[model samples]
Target chain A: MPIHYPNGRRFHETNTKKRSPAPKKISYSNRGMTLEEDLNETNRYYLEHGLAVIHKKPTPVQIVSVDYPKRSAAVIKEAYFKQASTTDFNGVYQGKYIDFEAKETKNKTSFPLSNFHDHQVVHMQKVIEQNGISFVILRFTQTEEIYLLDSRFLISYYQNMDTTRKSIRKSDIEKNGHLIKMGFHPRVDYLKIVDSVYFSN
Target chain B: MPIHYPNGRRFHETNTKKRSPAPKKISYSNRGMTLEEDLNETNRYYLEHGLAVIHKKPTPVQIVSVDYPKRSAAVIKEAYFKQASTTDFNGVYQGKYIDFEAKETKNKTSFPLSNFHDHQVVHMQKVIEQNGISFVILRFTQTEEIYLLDSRFLISYYQNMDTTRKSIRKSDIEKNGHLIKMGFHPRVDYLKIVDSVYFSN
Candidate 1:
């Protein structure tokens, strides 16, 4: 006997219920995985390869109420997500402090300044003042392009937003920012760009 | 009319809540605040005075379910506390990466190894291998003494735990670690010890 699904697909009467193999030319980039997931995978690869030690800060949540239904485990009953005070990703790389925020925009021509918060811009400035490397990873999702924009340039643009344009043009980013080439194992090899830009003698 | 307690003590009629402007003999070290609260206050002071930027990472929680009863807010109905992958406090100071785990013990003689997890030790090792400064802030609550113990000594001790004692003795900590003097504005001035140990020329 064969078990039939709603689409009239039947499972063969076998001990191992194996499905058909996946297509050989499947593109992982377009497989609906979120940008954060890709970055997490990249970080894991970096950690395993002993290249760098970086991690995304866990999302902060304000717990309001809890229920201790059993003595062993406590259950959170009510909580709300809290705004993060600093950038998402941070770690040590080659004896230098690395801190950055990642954002993806579907726009084609410009990267909006509204994607960044005032506190985050201020935090990045502090990191730069301390001589630590700080930058933003902006992904133009429509074109599948990513650029690492230094905080120094970002701060100048942020401070002059009252007089200048509210967003940075794609042409300016193409000129100033380091384009990160997509990779298979690490996904986003941003550290390679960091080495060339910040550590190059 | 005033509210009275079950023991017939009137709230407004009591003079226990009143305090006199007394002599400067009170010691903040003996105050009822927990070690975590004091560290949080110290970090806040550091941030406000432009000294160092450090923060205690929030408690991690694994959210199992959420209820979107309204469009305005998503209420967390069930969640469990998750063990943190990295140490609690991490930040940059003077272009150097700083990472550490803080622990307070009620035991008078030694700090127990059971307080630390295997993964935290591994994480600290990775931080040190990358040339970042890593350590543990151990506070003996009974004696109100705090010491910054470097990860090198910690890793050595952790490795030989099977043959050696299960805890780091107070004498060992006093000899190997830097004693952090308690302060007024910043309760625990651990960065002063960091400056002397890692940055002093």
Candidate 2:
């Protein structure tokens, strides 16, 4: 069944074992792009044009096995996470600190609250307390439609995780999130909204 | 013979591998208490107490191997770096972004510039272009003294790699950088300088 979000977009559903898309649609890596790759390229474009400065926060890895085949370079053999992180990208946009996580989901019905981690919610809350702007950029894999959801809504739902309401309906995301238009050079040009909301300059 | 840094701190000539003196020194399954561990704890304390906020930039790693134990969890099997990273930590402090690399050296005499990768210097330059503050924190393992050297100094010498003056002299860092007084709570209390420089209010 085609999953319909109240906001209007329809999400196509499928079960695949790999990170790569099955046969018909786009394969994340085959487009010669991972989410990080696209954003990094986008950030470079932004940096060059003097539009805005942003970057992917490095993935925190706890490396365990290292092989010193030579004296110069060492290779990681094993590793694990110290803990869950807050987000993937964060930086200054027009004098205000901006933080966010970018995620892609294949679920047609709803973007599962399970997609959002507990620690990430905590991180966003701390950002709010410090008066920083935090949000999540969510993309429905089937439709390739992307939306930016404010971290406030995310945090509120996160706190009520124990309550009757758990998963945020797809309709809510489409309504609350600012729809970001996809572009050619940067792919996802999100700073357009930043200028409208945070800078106003 | 012990490595002779112009700074007065002394590392033992014998490589007995003396246990770190502080009882609270970080030691979990990972590589003892990493430079990241101390900085993170420090950043958190800084945040809770209204001290300057700092965060370690995730290390940019290339994933060559990944194993899916189950559909629920993705296990990374192997990874490497496409290129070196700029530094470990960068974030906003008092309406200004703060960026820096933290390193600990057993050599009492001086820090080896080899510890820093080339791309990191380039990263700092980019951050500076955006009017961000960039720096390096050098910990003399023998003395456990933490010094914050502004990126300007590191950049000037880093650029002159073709000529002499590759590694920064300990004496130069001691004179130019702010000597951070290590404390019980924060481990490395760097926010004191941030407060003086950015947030006097």
Q: Which candidate number has the best lDDT?
A: 1
User: Which pairs of residues clash in candidate 1, taking residues 3 or more apart in a chain or in different chains?
Assistant: none
Instruction: Please compute DockQ, using alpha carbons, for every candidate against the native two-chain complex.
Output: 0.28, 0.22
**Deviation of model 1 at A79, angstroms:** 0.5
Q: lDDT per residue, candidate 1, A1-201, as tens digits?
A: 123212222121121111112222223454543355567778888888888889888766667766656336667777766667788889999778899999877789999998888988988988887788999999887777889999998888888887567999999999999999978778789999999999999
Candidate 1 per-residue lDDT over residues B5-119, each given as its tens digit: 1323322112211222222232344565545556777887877777777777767677766665643666667766777789988888888889999888888998898878888
**Backbone clashes in model 2, listed as residue pairs:** A58-B58, A64-A78, A65-A77, A65-A78, B5-B109, B62-B80, B86-B120
lDDT for A107 (candidate 2): 71
What stretches of model 2 exceed 4 Å from their correct place? A1-36, A70-72, A80-83, A107-110, A161-164, B1-37, B47-53, B70-77, B81-83, B106-112
Task: Report residue A10 deviation for candidate 1 (angstroms).
Answer: 31
Best model per TM-score: 1
What DockQ does candidate 2 score? 0.22
Task: Please give the lDDT score for candidate 2.
Answer: 0.65
The CAPRI classification for model 2 reads as incorrect
Off by over 4 Å in 1: A1-29, A163-165, B1-29
DockQ for the candidate 1 complex?
0.28
